[model samples]
Target: MMASVYDIWGAGFETTVATLQFAIIYLLNYPEVQRKLHEEMDGVIGREQELTMDDQKRLPYLCATIQEVQRASNVAPINFVRTTTEDIVVAGYLLRKGMNVIPQMPSLHLDDKLFPDPERFDPKRHLDKQGNFVKSDYVMPFSLGKRACMGESLARMELFLFLGTMVQKCEFQSVDKDAPPKIAVTP
Candidate 1:
């Protein structure tokens, strides 16, 4: 437990900051969506009340926006590369032994099939027919399968709690009034 504590401190902070940055960027870009989230929060938690972990379930739009942010951010642009131990068939393509494998997280997140109009920053994309929060399988921001990040649950819950509360309390705006903040793209 103490082993990666040092590593986790820096890496964890980096992730949390990046997630919040993206959330702020998206909210600034789309005022309508921001207003919708604000309205939803006001309705559920009320403007004068503070948000708590229990409020996450009640904040569907806020939760959806956070998910969309993570989906769009894909912060860990380059995932750990693993080599194939033996030849395997993937997506109808045959892989050779010892071949390097790179998980294209951003590409998958932006896939039009799993997520319709993937390029658009729409929280409704994560909403169900009943307008409830619906997690997307396409969001592999923390990688996927057996090789996924170990702190996925903690990180996700932290982001949701932090961002949900922040958005509920204050109005976020970029420093530049005229120029729109750029969407962070990691190549």
Candidate 2:
């Protein structure tokens, strides 16, 4: 029971906290993004009300920002190290059973071809020309597929709720805008 409990906390809660820290730091550094979140929340959900999953549809920029945070933070450095169950052809080479493979998440998240100007931290990247929140399969913060992180949906909901609520209530500010925090990319 204790081992299971610890696994849940270590795998999910800790990573979520780290991701949230990155988001808060980014919000502090980029006031414009913060303003956009505030505006969206106020316009769509209002200050007094709790934001729902339904409200997420109306807040494109905020949702994008959350995605950007997840991508940028790369909190879960190693996501579901996988092994082949049986012999399979992968892109030509045969991957036999017992061969271990891990997705290099940062490589995918920071790919210039997939995300133009990848280092800019621009949430607008996730937006379509129609100004809709478009999700990218490439943004695999919680990994992907059947063997992906167990807490993925829970993490996402937590991110939206906590971040939405916090931004709805308080404004984040940087004491020195010129010397904003330089968050390290976790390996």
Model 1 per-residue lDDT at 138: 80
**Residue-wise C-alpha lDDT for candidate 2, range 21-77, written one tens digit per residue:** 999898887789999988888888888987888888888888999999988878876
Off by over 4 Å in 2: none
Q: Which residue pairs collide in model 2, if any? A: none
Question: Model 1 — TM-score against the truth?
Answer: 0.90
Model 1 spans with C-alpha error above 4 angstroms: 1-3, 96-98
The best candidate in terms of lDDT: 2
- Please provide, for model 1 over 28-142, each residue's C-alpha lDDT reduced to its tens digit, 9 standing for 90 to 100: 8988888998899888988778677788788888889988988887888778898888999999999999999988888788778888887789999888899899988888778
Clashes of 1: 0
Total backbone collisions for each predicted model: 0, 0
Residue 80, model 1, lDDT: 86
Model 1 accuracy (lDDT, Cα): 0.84
RMSD of 1: 1.9
* C-alpha-based local distance difference test score of model 2: 0.86
